[model samples]
Every structure is written in structure tokens, then in C-alpha cells.
Target: RTSIPINSVDQAIGAIRTKIIFGGLVISVLAAVLGLFVSRRIARPIGQIRTWAESIARGQFQYRPSITASEEIEALSVSLSRMAEELRERIDTVIRQRNEIEAVLSSMVEGVVALDMEERLISMNQAACRMLGIRMSDMQGRSIQELVRSTMLHQFVNDTLSSRKPTEMDIPLSSDGEVIVNCHGTLLRDAGGRQIGAVVVFNDVTRLRRLENIRREFVANVSHELKTPITAIKGFVETLRDGAVKNPKDADRFLTIIDKHVARLEAIVEDLLRLSRIEQGAEQGEIERIDSRISEILRTAVQVCHVRADAKQIGIEISCPEETRAWVDPPLLEQAMVNLLDNAINYSEEGKKVRIRVTQEEGGMVISVHDQGCGIEKKHLSRLFERFYRVDKARSRQLGGTGLGLAIAKHIVQAHAGRLTVESIPGRGSIFSIHLPTNPPRNGSASHGDPLQPS
Candidate 1:
């Protein structure tokens, strides 16, 4: 209703517009500031939680999130901390179990190989590496066939994987030398019984096979030896019963021959028994050991064989220090020495010299019986100590030899932690020596003892 000038009215309108715009700008600024503070408060805790989660994913379970803004965030941090601790414990347990499995595999004497589902080698123990002639580094992640080059092994693994069943075979490897290994392959399965891989185990059976062969041969030899004497005795007895008993001279001769054969049979049986006893004693660890003068043992052996040497017209020579000492079983050592002396005397020609010598050698004492006789051939030396093994079977029987004396002597010496060896040249001479330890071990492991000076 009040009439104003146009300039004044326009100025008033501009002022009111300016004031409204200023008020709006101020309100917008206040809203922006409050929004920034609220957003920052929420984002800061979330950022910390995210960082903590990332750390956990990276296996940093030792780190903890610190959140103080909200109860929900604090509860989440606590839950996360507990989860990390449980995970760490479970991981440590897994690592410990893996280490224990590794230790058990390493200590095994038999070879063990583990392969992954991809047929790659995952683990191999020391014995496995040694048996296969490969290094651990070279075998890892490599195919089993590439490492072992054996058709049998490859087939075994494939069969086990395909059937999820165990398989076994004897594999012969001749890389470094001939080796027979008994291999067993089995499937490795997960907790759900799903086949994951294959495990192959190997055991060396070469020595066991050889021992079995020896046992068979020994049984055959014993049967033959026993049968021969029985057959001869039966044949001679039947001949006497048929007619020879009627003539006195023939009867007397037959009786003499039968008596000689009977005596020989008795000797053989006795010697076999003695050898068996000695071997049993050694195996049972029941050898009687004593410290005795070496000279005394040699003297006793010589005296026992003096009559035989005189009968054969052989001269006996002794060469040894007077007071040399050794650890030995007195009776067994005397028996061993006597057997050697008897062998030397029986094998020597008439008037040949048989020498009994004792000397201190490297870490031991050597007692040798030397004979100037028809010596042993090299081919016969390897089995010279075997029971009933004779270089000249007829000659040995003619000389009243049982063929078990050397075998018995060897066992006796071995029981005393000694070795028996022979050196000979055909038609020249033979020397049978017993190498005894100077100081025998109180336990059962003595082979060579401390060195001793000749007294």
C-alpha cells in the first residue's frame, strides 16, 4: 500500500536475496562439516578391521586389531583374535605331525618312496636314495620312472594307482652291482578314503637268498657224507657173510678193514658233533675267554701232535717268543692249534719239517702252522674251512682225516674273535694261520684289538 521509489524497492529486494543466499551457504557448510566427521568416525574403524583381516590372511596371526569406536567393532576384533589363535595352533600341530612322520621314515632300514598323484616323487628316505643310487634333490618332482628306470617298479606304481590296491614284486637292479630287492607298493589315501598317491617300500633280500642256498647245500652234503660210510660198511658186511668168513686169513683181513672203517666213521661223527657244539656256542655267546700265555698254548699243541709227527717221520720245529700273551679260550685254542698241527703233520712228506710259529702282527697275534707238503690249490682255498670239503677226498680218508677238523678249528678260532687263513703254493708248502686279538673285548664285538709287542 505504501508507494516507494523504484530504485529503493530494487535495492531492498537485492538485500533480501543476498541475506537468503548467505544463510543457505552457511547451512550447507555446517552440514558438510558434520557429515565429514560422522563418515570419518565410521570409516576409521572399518579401515583398521580391513587391515587386520589382511594381516590374518597373510599369516600374521600375532597381530590384533585395536577398535574403540563401537561395541560391534570391538566384538568383531575379539572374535577375529580367537580365530587367529586357533588357526595358528592347528597349523603348528600339522607341522609337528609332518616332522614326526619324516623322522620315522628316515630311521627305517628298508627303502621307502612316496609319490604324488601326478606320479612325481614327493619323498624318499636315505636308504631309498642309497638303494636307487640317486640324490634327494635329483628325485624331487621327477617321475618315478625317470628316477628308477625299472619297468617292474613303474608297472607296480601304475597298478597300485589304478586299482587302489597293494602290489608286490621282486625287482633285480644291476646298476652298480647285482641287487635283488623285494618291493611292496600300496596306495596312499586321504581321510575320505580317496586315493592320493602310491607308496613303495623295498627290502634287500640278497643275503637271505644266499643263506638259504647255503643251508640247502649243507643238508645235501651231510646226507651224502653219512650215506657213503653206511653203504661201504653194509657192502663189506654182506661180502663177509657170503663166503669170506670161511677163510681165516680173509676173515682176519676183512675184520681189520671193517674195524678201520668203523673207526673212521666214529671219528667223523665225533668231529661233526664237536663242530656243531662250537658253532652253537658261538651263536649263543657262551665262549669261555681267558688270558693265557701264547707259548704255553703252542707247546701244548705241539706235545699233543708229537706222536703223530714221529709216526709220519716229520720233524717238528717251534719258533715263538717264550712269554707272549693273548686273550683266548685255553681249551678251544689248544684244540684249534692241535688240529692245525695234526693237519700239517699228516700232509707233510716223510722227514719234512713242520713248523709252529707265533708272531705279533698288526693289532693281533698270529699262530701259524707251516708244512712242507703237497700244498693246496688256489681253487680249493675259498672253501677250505667248509665241512666235508676236501681238496683230495681219497687222500684225506687214507690219512685218517675226517674232513671236519679244519671246519671245527675255524669255528673255535672265530668264537675267540679271531680269523683263520691259509696261504699256500701247490707242491711247495702251506701255512695255516690263526689271527687272534691281543686284547679281546669284554663284549662280543672284538675282531682286532690293541697292538701288542712281542715279548
Candidate 2:
């Protein structure tokens, strides 16, 4: 109020105008600076956020946003980085799990096949490739009928596809080979019970089925063998009581027949017991390294059956190389050799020759017995080693054979970790070979000497 002077109108007007201009310019400059700072803070953060989202989409969540001095922006950047890292880790875990599952499915031993309702192969493992003899890629979208050559398997797969039920079947490969496949398939469904696809699992049971067949044969043979001896004993006893008991001479004749029957029973019992022992892990304590002198064992067997061989006029011949040897139990091998010789003498024609040969084979020794006998038919060979199985029931009974000799030999050979094989013709000569391991038992009563090498 003291500075406003009324003395000069021009000075007062100029002062008021200058002060008004200065105030407006100062306000304008301040507003411009404020707008620039606000736009930078908003636009810069949004750009960084957009780039981070793109990085996550592209599977690279490695980028971290720089924090600004603005508290809100810094907090937002920290949260965004945490979310991106979590997403990356989740995606990585999923990839790793998928790889592990794929590896397991590819390496499975069974033939794996998945299908849609259309009977086409959706997915299959590597083993399925080998089993079906087709490439995995080739089978992926192909119809089952086109891939499966076997009619039975083709039909089974079709049935499963139509019915959405599981099936199992046996498939034969050749005249001498077969496999049992237990297939289980289920209709895949979503939570709403809508049909999606099917998964099939295959389990192999070939060995188990073979063992069951062997067991059945054993039971049948045992029944037939026991029936013969029991029938004979009953007949002879009744005859003796009716006539032979009154006359001493007649009684003596009957007694001789009875003694043969008793011997047959004793032989059967002994063979059964021996088989039991062999099956119980071979009593590792009783194993021994025995003589491999094939000539000696064969000669001894011939001597034991000399009377029987002479009665039939069967000529026994030995052809063993001096260097041939085997690792065996002395008593067991001698008995096996004796059984073969006895069979030869009993079944051969008059004046026909029987041959015994010892030779070397891979990993073991081979002792063979050949006979010009009434040879076994092809069908009977499969059950020759079964207990009490016989090629000719009447002849075996007449000869007082218990029909367990071959079975006993087979068990003993298996107990020693060896193999037994036979080749025969219906009317020609038959050859029986016993393959003995050259190596002795690791834990047995007798110490292993240098095992005899086949020459």
C-alpha cells in the first residue's frame, strides 16, 4: 500500500502488467514439467510389463524388470517377475514329466497298443514293433487287420474294438512253437463317461502253459503205470489162492511172478523219491564231480544187461573217443546209461545192433545211445521224460518196466544243470543224448578237478 504511488499513471500501469505476466509464465512452465514426469512414469512401466509377458509366452521367463524409485512401480515389477518365474518352472516340470513317461512307455517289454473306436492303432511301444514285426511309425495309424498277419489275433483285436471288452488268446508261431498272450483292454472314458480311446496290455504266459501241460501228462502216465501193476498183482494173488496155494509146486511158480511184481513196485517208488529230491534244488550238498569216462560207463551198462541182450540176440557196440569226458554223479550216470541199454535190448529186433557214442559239444560233453529198436512215434517224444509215460503200454508191462526210468534221468540231468535230448523215427533207429556240463558244481561234496573237455 505504501509503494503504490498516484503521482505517475504510466508507472503504476506498467508495474501491474509486468507482475501479472511473470506469475502466468511461472505457472505454465511448472505445469509442463509436471505433465512430462507423469507420462514417463505411466508409459515406461507399461512397456516393461508388455515385454515381460511376451518373454513368458516365448518360454523365456529369464528377464527381470528394473525397479524404479517409485514405490508402486517397484512393487509391481517384483510381483510380475515372481509370476513369470513360477510359470516357467511349471512349464519345465511338465516337460520333464512328459519325457519320463514317454521313456517308460517306449521301453516296456510287452507289446503295447492303444486304439480308438475305429480299430486303428493309435500308439505302440518299441517292443510291439518287434513282436508284430512292424515299424512303430508304420503301425501308428494303420488298421489292426493290416498289421496283424495271424487271423486269430486279427479277430481278437477287432472283437475288442467293437465290444470294448478285454480278450486273451494263444498264438502259434510254427509247428513246434507257440505263445500265450493274455490281453487286457479297457474303454477309456472322460469324466462325463464319453468314449475316448482304449489301452491294451499284453502279458506273456508261454512258459507257464507249457509247464501245466507237462504236469497233466505226468498225472496221466502215473495212473496208467500204477493200474498195470495193481491189476497184475490182484490177478496173480487170486490165482494163487484158488489153485497154487494147494500145490507146493504151483505155489513156487506163482511166487516167482509175484516177486517180479513186487520189484516193479519198488522201482516205481524209488524213482518217485529220486525225482522229489532232484526238484528240491538238487541238494547242493550231495552233488559231486564224477568220472567222465563214457566208455567205462557204457561198458558197465552193457555188462549189467548182458543176459537180456543175449536173450534178444541184440549186439551192443561201443564207440567212445578216449578224450571224451563228462562231469556227473557216478551212480546217477551209471543208472541213466543202464536204462538206455536196457531199453535198447528190450525193444530191438533179433541180432540188431545198439550203439553208444561219446563226443564233445559246446559247453559240455555229449554221450549218445542209439538203438535199432521199435522207435517212438513223433507225438510220444514230447512226453518221453514225463513220469511213467510209455510208448507201448502192453510191451512195457510185460517187460516188468515201471516206466519211470527216463523221467528219473531227466530230473537228475536238470539237477546237474545239464540237458537231455532225443531223436527218433517211427520205424528207424532212435538216438538218445545226454549233455553233461564240463564245469563241476560250485558248492558240492566233491571238489572240481579239471573238467573233462570233449575231444
Candidate 3:
């Protein structure tokens, strides 16, 4: 029975071949899956490297591509990693340099504004905004023409942008003030010398201009001061020689006029010296505890001008709260108050009343001098505090004014970290105000007033 069960060789061969074919199909399917996994693995590493390289070119230092391959791709991955590291280092260095330049520009007292070739403001520091009376947030990225109001500055910027050269312009920033800015510009180029854009740097010289104007005014004022007395002396001598002596009364009158002129001239010289001393001392006026003797100062100023007020039939009124007080150098405050009061007296017409009021306003105290006199025109109001500026030059001389009161007052206010402003309308009246902080700045900070308030 075992012999008869034996199969043919051909049947065995066919069974073996079928098993081999099935085995081959299984191996082929497994190979396809393995190949897909391997390709995905390789492609993922390349993609990660590509992403990192893109980030590096864009100046990002955080991209760190991993290296896991062990073939030709591995070597390429190593090189890419090295390149990314070097790129990060260079980018960090550039950032540090940029920050240093920004710090220097921000610390300057004068303004600095930089613009790109597109005529848009690239950047500006805090001092620049302050000097221009603009907010930093609003000034950045704006067109140069939109930001700068002065035609001189606009034209100068256009010329500099086009010419790519350094320029200087005396830009009148305000009716009361002018700024001298030294502008420098150049085209920004890439390493290949291809023009990318332009850059402009604006350096403010407003304070320098103000100082120069002061010096000019001083010279002219001194000359006029000297000439007034000399002219009076000549007039008196002529009157004495031209038979005025025949009438002792007229001769006495001429002599009295000459004496008055001499006193005025002497007073002018004395004021000039006082102002010089004050300005020199201004830088050294170390922050100190100031008295709040607002009432006492007001009383003294009013008392000194009382006789004059009575002569002009003008009454001096004091309206202030008992708690009114301010941080102030008493001497400086008293002097400034005297100047304000004297100005009211000089400007007020005869029989018109003047009022002096003091009270707390917000974080500060305000002292307002109100006069019902020939009010100043709007155009002259801004320069009212300027040295030697006069609304009526003839009337100022007649009133024995040295034309230095308002200037002295302005300096005193500045030294005290306060603001002085005037509001007037012709044929109506005027109000001159001095606002000072209520608290004396501690630790002797030069910024004695509140930072929220700009003087």
C-alpha cells in the first residue's frame, strides 16, 4: 500500500514551483514598504535642513538642524550645521552693534532722526521727538515730508536724498524758535554695491541757535541801553545851553530827565550783569529743597509795587488759597514774581486793575498775573518772554523798562523747572502764568518738575 501511494515527479515539481512563486510575491511586497520608509526618512532630513537654511538667511539664530544620516547626505548636513552656527554668530554681532548705536543716539540731548531712501522715517530717538515736540510712536515710519513741517527741512531732505551728500539747514521749527540741523545722507548698498536704499541723519542745533540769538540781542540791547543815556545827556546839555537856564524850572526839568535816563541806563547794565551771573549759575543750581512760601513771596512782590499801582490808580488784588504752595528757590521765585508784577504794572493802562492769583493746579501750582491793559497782539505773544522783545518799544522806554524783565523771568522759570506762558488778544486783556511743581524733586535731580509736563 505504501508503494502505491508514491506520486509522480512532475506533480511534486509543480507544487514546489507554486510555493516558490508565492514566496517571491510576499518578498516583493515587503521590499516596497521598506523602500517607502527609507525614502521618507531621507526626505525628512533634507526638508529640515532646507527650513533651517532659509531661517539662517533671514537672520534667525534659533534654527538648529539635526544630523542623523550616515552617507553623503551626512557630510552635507554637517556643513549646513556649521554654516548655520556661523550665520547666527554674525547676526548676533550685527544686532549688538545696532543696539549700541541706538543707545548713543537716544542719550543725546538734541534730536536725531534717520530716514530711508524711500523717504520714510527709518527711526528716531527719544531726544529727537522731544526737540521736535512730536511723539515717538507717531513719528516713526512716516514720510519725511509728512513729519517735517518746515519747507527748508523738506527741500533739504529732498536734496540730500537725491544728491546723497551732507547738508545743513536752519529750519524754523516754530515762530519763536529755530533749529540748525546738520543733515548727512548716503545711499545704502549691499555687498555687491547694489543700491538698496538711502539713510539720513538729522542732528538738531536748536539750543545753539537760541544761544546765538540771545548773544545778538544782548549786544543790541547793551548798545541801545548805552545810547539812551548819552542822548539824554546831550539833550540836557543842549537845553541848558539854549536859554532853558533863563527859566530855573525848565532847567531843573531837563536835569531831572537826564538823571532819570542815567538811572535807567545803569539799571540796564546791572540787569545784564545779573542775567549773566544767573545763566552761569544755572548749570550749577544743584537741586535743593525749596520752600513753599508762596504767600510771603506774593505779599512782598505786591508791596514793592504798591506805590506804583496807587499812582496809576490801579488796584493790586491778591486772590489765592491759604494752602497754596510750591517747591521753589525763594530768591529766584521772588525775583521772577517781581518781574511778572512789574510787567503787569508797566503794561496796564492808568485806572485799569491788575490781579495776582495763586492756586494749586493738578500736580503743580499756578501763579497768574491778569492785567486789563492794552493787550498784546497774537503774533507778538510767543516772543513776549524773549529778551529785549517789546510790544511797544517807545512805551517800554517811557516806562523805564530795560526790556529784560521777561527774559529774566523766563530764565528763572527754566531754572526752577517750570513753564511760563502768555494768553492775550488785542483790545482785550492778557494773562501771564507761571506753573511750578508742588513737590521739590528729591535727590537733587535736575528734572525738578514733573516729567509728565514739558516745559
Local distance difference test scores for all models: 0.85, 0.77, 0.77
Query: What overall lDDT, based on C-alpha atoms, would model 1 receive against the true structure?
Result: 0.85
Q: Per-residue alpha-carbon lDDT of model 2 for 373-399, expressed as tens digits?
A: 888999989878877778888898788
Sort by TM-score, best first. 1, 2, 3
Clash count (model 2, backbone only)? 1
Q: Least accurate stretch of 10 residues (summed lDDT) in model 2?
A: 168-177
C-alpha TM-scores of all predictions: 0.81, 0.72, 0.64
Which of the predicted structures, 1 or 3, would earn the higher lDDT when compared with the native? Answer: 1
- Could you give candidate 1's per-residue lDDT for residues 310-411 as a string of tens digits? 987888888988778787878889999889988988888998999888998998989888999999999899889988788998898788787888999999
User: What's model 2's TM-score?
Assistant: 0.72
True-vs-predicted CA distance for residue 376, candidate 1, Å: 6.1
TM-score of 1: 0.81
Pairs that collide, model 3: 111-128
Candidate 3 wrong stretches, greater than 4 Å: 1-181, 187-198, 206-211, 231-255, 286-296, 320-332, 413-416, 436-455
Q: Please give, for residues 4-89, the per-residue lDDT of candidate 3 as tens digits.
A: 43467678888999999999999999999999999988988888878877887787757676668758888888888787787778
Indicate which candidate wins on TM-score: 1
